[model samples]
Target: LGNTIVFPYSYKSSYKSNLLGSSTSPIQDVNMEEEFELKDGDVVTEVVDGIPTIIFFDQVHKYIERRMAKTIIMKLLGRSIGFNVLLKKITSLWCPRSPIQLMDLENDYYLIRFNSEDDYNKVVFGGPWVIFGQYLTVRLWSKDFSTSQSKVDTQLVWVRLPGLPEGFYSDFLIRAIGQLLGQVVKLDAHTNSARKGRFARLVVLIDLKKPLMSKIKINGRIQRIKYKSLPIICFSVWHVWT
Candidate 1:
């Protein structure tokens, strides 16, 4: 779908991952060390349900989305190409995806959804929602896979954004990895904790920001990670049953 223009950016060099799923949210410290602040690769790992924890990234990266705004959605059938520049430049905000949107539930609580009757009377703007069974779920899912009496039903849920300010994603290229498949892929990170020495551990159940929807898996786990600049919220590993 992104056939219009190609960016002069390289995906590999601009990012790097760690071999261990360690805490990546760089601990804020003024006198800690410059090497720790600017150095890339912060690993975050955790254990859950007797299974090795997975690594995921919920970075509040101040992403500057520069794109050639299209005037029309059509093929090159000798049609006049209208020039469209970027519109609605929002700064210091949140960025959602074209599918599901990040929303504010109330106070410090936020949820994701495609649609919601519970929010029927609630005033919501610039968000995403969809129909799910009898109720609307933020992590929207498709119809049940079972039509038989013995079959079971399931759906993929949209992932939730971090506790970062919703304003950080104000109209950014929004994308939601539902809770059902919260981790779009797997990767690794290099982490060092007082309990665990500096080492690389394979990270599982990992997902990236919208731009990095591509999944990576190997050796029953993944290593190396490039995270976005986001405020720290949680430091536990998340596992989404595949």
Candidate 2:
């Protein structure tokens, strides 16, 4: 935990909502798992449709613990039919169209891997500091994804640290931008100054709000791609202050 910042598990949702229906958020127990990289102090929250699915004690709601959220969602789904009934729903996390591919345990499950770095950059805010840019992502995870190991069949957020040096940039940025799309989104994307010799432009997005569109973050540098749109918001922010 020295150079590696300790993002605690407190950020994990304390409750969950059955997003399937009820017109409100549900309550759930944060299913702690070995895969949880979140430490014991990291501030986190789980919410849906504006209502926090779990109680939180963080400075702000930013990254959406993809695995945690997925678990909560799974609980929600399971609640509908009771936890004992896996039925064919276990595969929904893999193929949405034909998630029900099998009933037995062999093809009965799937893995949850969140590595859609390209997808996150395209839709919401974008970032990458290297001049030519070899690796531009910070964190990526998946919910019911396809992996080589036994399919987790649950949400899992993975980290993809930027190619930049430590402590220069990403200080003010959320750990995982894509995970916290909707409910509320904010970021403080920044880059290591070109003169710093860090040779990396840092983009830290400080998320301070709630869900925008599922897991989209909104901040000054957010893309108009959504990258393109950031300028518009910054322009507006500048005008209001002036």
Query: Among these predicted structures, which one has the highest TM-score?
Result: 2
Deviation in Å, model 1, residue 153 alpha carbon: 24
lDDT at 157 for candidate 2?
A: 20
User: For candidate 1, what is the TM-score?
Assistant: 0.16
Report lDDT (CA) for all predictions: 0.22, 0.27
Cα deviation of 49, candidate 1, in Å: 36
Q: Each candidate's root-mean-square deviation in Å?
A: 23.3, 17.9
- Residue-level lDDT tens digits of model 2 in 1-242: 00100011112111122222123211222122223245556655667898887553442233445333331111121112322233223322122221111111122221122223333342233322111212211222333333342322221122222333344344334334433432113333333222343323323332313122212224443322132122112422221110
lDDT of 1 by residue, 1-242 (tens): 11111111111110122112123412112112222222233335678888888553333121101111111111111112221111111111223222222222221122223222323112122222221111211122222212131211221222333332232232221112212234332112212121223322221222322223323232344323323312121334322211
TM-score of candidate 2 versus the correct structure, residues matched by position: 0.19
Question: Largest lDDT belongs to which candidate?
Answer: 2
List candidate 1 stretches off by more than 4 Å.
1-105, 108-181, 185-217, 220-222, 233-242
lDDT of 2: 0.27
